[model samples]
Target: MTSNPTSSPDPIPNIATASEAFHTGDELRERWRALMGPLGFSERLLWFAFVDTTGHILPALNQLPLDGPPEPYLADLLMYRLSDVIDGHDVVSVAMLITRPGADAITPWDRGWARLFTTAADLAGVAIEPIFRANAVDLVQVSDPRADGRSVA
Candidate 1:
């Protein structure tokens, strides 16, 4: 039988055992580096925070899945898990501030949290400044300060 050049089978490599998988720190860094390539800056920062704080974010992420919507409790749990790393003293406060307010307006909380997260990411050397600036522009445009009973009108 002739093997077609375009029909190569997928290569399966040896997988790490459960105990080996849970080995944190440098091991986790290696896994993350392999999983998320060089351009995955945000993920790398989060992984660093996870490794620094509790040596693992995989357990929390594992509780979720690759498919479907994450449970509400999972979001809460994630926020709690990231609290220290994000330096967010009040997760509920932060959450409440960012939720949608109406059809066309970006809430103050959204801006606040963006600023906070962006600041934290900058301090962590995550190079998220451009993302933050883009979002800030979007928020300003969506809210339309002049239309929000502001003196700018």
Candidate 2:
């Protein structure tokens, strides 16, 4: 389940430096877009980027295996573990991205994952920015829908 339709090399998008701020959903979505880059993948991956209290991005961008919906218990455990890392920080939040092979549209499955993640973060008392999804066609913000009843990319 993949597509490499382009004969030319795929362009690598620029990554945000540690100094860059991701204060808004738009900024976070841009980061996800850069990380995703003309999306085409054989499997799904969950990516995370931490933001400090001042909105500056942490140095690391994490990637984890994702075969299906996240286990509730595991999600809790993961968030709790990460909480320790930012415990002493002045302020911190999380940004998530799900990249898989598919069309641009957000599916019910994607919404389900977003709900699970939001719930887990709520339980852990962790703040999370909007979540984004990158598919074979486009990258979009999945957590919050626009006022016009549309998803933004």
CA RMSD of all predictions: 16.2, 5.3
lDDT of 2 at 6: 58
- State the lDDT of candidate 1 residue by residue for 1-153, as single tens digits: 112356552222223321134232234333333333222111101122222222233322121221222234433444555454443221111111121222233445444444444444334433211111111111122232222331110
Question: In terms of TM-score, which candidate is strongest?
Answer: 2
Off by over 4 Å in 2: 1-13, 16-19, 88-91, 144-153
Residue-level lDDT of model 2, residues 32-85, one tens digit each, is 666666677778877887877777667678987778775677678767876776
Candidate 2 global TM-score:
0.76
Estimate candidate 1's RMSD in Å. 16.2
Whole-model lDDT per candidate: 0.28, 0.68
lDDT score of residue 106 within candidate 1: 42
| Model 1 stretches astray by more than 4 angstroms | 1-101, 129-153
Error of 2 at 2 (Å): 19
The count of backbone overlaps in candidate 1 is: 1
